[model samples]
Target: MNKKIAASLASIVALSTLAAACGTPADTGTKTGGDATQAPAQKVKLTVWHNYSGDDLRAKAVRGQIDKFKAAHPEVELDAQAIPPDGYRQRLKTVAAANEMPDVFFTNSGSMIKEFYDGGLIQSIMPLLNKQTEWKNNFTPGAFDPLSFNNEVYAVPVNASVTSLFFYNKTLFEQNGVKVPKTWDELLAAVKTFKDKGITPISLGNKAAWLAQSSILSSLANRVTGTDWFLKAVKQDGAKFTDPEFVQALGLMKGLADAGAFQQGFNSLDNTQMEQYFISGKAAMMIDGAWALTNMAATGTKEQLDQIDVTVLPSVPGGKGDPNTISGGAGGGFAVSKKPTGKQLDAALELIYTISGPDGMKAVAEANQIVNYKMDVDQSKVTSLFYKAYNLTKSVTFTPVYDAYLSSQGAEAINNGLQELLMGGKPEDIAKKLQDAQAKSIGK
Candidate 1:
């Protein structure tokens, strides 16, 4: 969380408490059940805020699950709203300002989760999960670690994601006589091969800026400075962004750009356009988040889809990082409100469990999206691309992306500075810019 955002939320929450209550009042009086000691099963009406507003496969799958959940629990009314994807944090902040936080909502696992937990805005679902042991065991090992703070889990793993990946068109590669690259030199050679054949070597949509940071630099940084150094720098423990290892990481990105490795005017292209280029076979390869598999499935042709595959960014020879490592983690999930009472809390917990559990994961798998849960999914029903991505993730040592590890301001600065670096800016200068932003961010 950014310090400014935290402070603003604190003030708003404080003020909102004076004029408004956190949640609706519900009757918890005794009702009919096997156990008379239990409170009445009051009806719960929950507002779920999420970012699946678009008509994509993930959204469709989520809506399908929500319908199933509704069918299973007819008494519960879930008013789910699809929030706009852009600047969602600002909208959340505004809602928090009014003390109208949703009963349950989608939240990422990093700084936002920590700040929400620290501010008493969200509650730990560990106790609920512990009680539901079967459901608890359905998550992949270490999946909950990102959502856990001080050994206590606060959120349920919903969407397990690996952000840094080389999504390539296998058809293009084979047609052009290019093989999947395993090392820096091989990757460069492939880039040259594609470039010489008048095909765009790689499609990068850096206009959004974070795409560069999340898709390329995040993994490259890991390959250069290693995860330990990056984590230490995130904590401001004497590891500076301007360090040689970090500078070298920036240099690698610039080198690729200079080599015409990416589509021309890539810095001006948004992620959507870049995806267009790749899906249409105008670009041979693209580096993107694992979540892109869903987009690819929805937008690509059967032939194109069959030819799609993924790999981790190739190793940089003599780099501190392992070639088997990649940038990834538990990206986002669901967290219940700390203030919901009576059946609202129960229903919210159930919603999280059902949506993030094995059944929900199966649905996600059916949609060709990777769910974070540990479950056996029928791979035959999904595309081969999904299996390739799954194997790629399982093989790599995961590292959190810079945005996930840094404060909002620091993360934004990194995205912007890296964009400048991609546009012919010096690595040292961008490194200093990132260092300065990180200084102020950590200080705050």
Candidate 2:
């Protein structure tokens, strides 16, 4: 696995030797002069884990930040493991169970963060956060809300994202005389218009099975039932996933597929293929995470970048939910494990601050990715397209992505059921399946 165990062992040995040579058996102090000579800072070794192994720009930016942090803190021994994103959650949970988690690790600000917090696997970041008011204020307002539990924050959110944005080709929309839809009916009309022109209205690649559920259905559910119903259903406070409103959200997914909104054989294609389809102009629009803005900038030509515009999904007609609400929260960031003392704790905290602080966020933004830190970038240095998409978060109300608030098992069931729904499963059936999963998650 090349998990960097050797580096850690070497660090432990070095630290042990240093500890053994300290003052006296009982002194425990490193000071050695009559004038209270200060000893050198104790050696600190920290293991950091993150889901950023690929050559994608996001991963590259993280790697760059780690390099900078290391260069700036030569006294701290930082062992970082960039695990593949696919297996990240499983690995995190496994290590967490063993109580041998890395000193610092990247995690989303959602259910898993709460799970870790409740299990005492993660620690509150307030100690360092309180001392750095300027750093804390650098985050966008409410960005840390999801990472909080029982009035204490557990992680520093690095990236902000909205999961329900529909990015469309402006040229295609203009050519087809189709305006960006502002409401449910207008959206369907635009879909019909594109269909009439023999153009695919949407490109969806759901082979991963999560794009439809987490990216699409999550937004639709928020549009139909709002955050209140979702919370009620998730908490089992008399509301249920099987409630008619929730089922109706499922039905909406079926209706879109039935209406031929997606490209043919979409279920067979993966997210990368869908991005290709959209960039190639084979599809008029794509529904995806706002984080895709970076990918688009990195891979798309200038013409394509100029033609792309992002907007929230249209509102559901006659639904209780607010149309302006979008499914998303603060994106993944670093969390400190409950373990670590003295210098180890200091190193972990420093790493978090260095990665998510203004300096780190500025470097991240320069890489064309959005950051949660509140700073206005120098416009001339970045593409205007990037700024356009980054500003989209301000207009919409944010809600948690479906899987973000659900347990792993609950999320898996929802994703599976949605894929089935795309293949002609009934909404009621899918709703019941999800309800069953939710019940199991809560031990009911």
Candidate 3:
């Protein structure tokens, strides 16, 4: 996440800052300011894509809003695709290389969105927001900062998120007579104890590559390298990934795998499979994002859900980071393709606002996810598991997610390198891979 998101997140710490419900943007085919969106008199077709493709509650909330938008605007024919996170980026890049971007698409903050903006791949949505003045005013101030570049807003964040947390089965921990770890040494002891009992100490699925980067290593690396040191390294400001502190962080992953912490073939398994391993009690712990809470709330049995509780990744020896913090916040969002105009721009603006606006934000909130909008919610409708995860954010600081802020090449190198590192690759070699990849951009 960016600085603006970090600043805005403090306002949402307890959900107590929330206001009464707000309204959605105006109807389709309406003109406001002179340069504002003007729907075409005839039918308009726009291509749309997003990463909320799984069957999880988070995905349903997003896709549900898209469905409503289609129904409400019959004059617009949307050719939409719901691609999984693993394949979504590459696909968008492929289309972009061919100069064939969709009319509107999903993207994250930091280097990912910056790449598109720098390449002239996206257009400013500021005029569209200016037209919907009331809707624009409702977002937590500074929520739009990450999506704005060169004083022009390009996208709107659908939600803010915490990308790392430890979800442990309380029943398993109690059954085994082991408590949650609060320090590196205690964590190692817990892993050894769980391993001795033939139970996987941690459930992990790294096949998609990102769980290794964003979920596992983001928080772990933060503990070892801290935010300031890491940002300097990211900017190549007298810092490199090959430094001993970052190397020590990479070693932690190797240390976990060597200690029999993760399940077999973790590099090949997907999140759905990992969730099954966790709920079945074969593994006592799972490390994932806040999004998992909603996915669990939707599909988990009440008994199963009740047995789970959330905790932060424990502190490291001589750690430079706070144990309570994790990598996440207002990052990924939606933007229109470069130079969209007339009917196409209108369709694109309406699509993003409808989903990221009041109705969409409320739908996301009801599914137990954090959002940028302020709306009163019925406490009874949200699951206890969600509150457990939600309230955990109150006491901690938030860190930048690795992928959210890293250059695409740097993100790629580490994501793949971590998989290799876990499979017995040397941490030094992997660290150098990132050092080289990032220098390509920052070095210049």
State the lDDT of candidate 3 residue by residue for 10-117, as single tens digits. 665334223212323444344667776453354687889899998888789999989989999898989989998888889989988999998889998777888899
How far does residue 213 in candidate 2 sit from its true spot (Å)?
2.3
Q: Arrange candidates by TM-score, highest first: which order? A: 3, 2, 1
**Which ranges of candidate 2 are over 4 A from the true structure?**
1-43
TM of each candidate vs. truth? 0.86, 0.88, 0.88
Give the range where candidate 1 is weakest over 10 consecutive residues by summed lDDT.
Answer: 19-28
What is the Å distance of residue 8 in model 3 from its true position? 48
* Candidate 1 vs candidate 2, lDDT winner: 2
User: What is every candidate's alpha-carbon RMSD to the true fold?
Assistant: 7.7, 6.1, 12.1
lDDT (10s digit) by residue, model 2, range 108-153: 8788788888788988889889988988987887888888888788
Best by lDDT: 3
> Which pairs of residues collide in candidate 2?
none
Model 1 regions lying over 4 Å from their true place: 1-43
| Better candidate number, 1 or 2, judged by TM-score | 2
Error of 3 at 33 (Å): 33
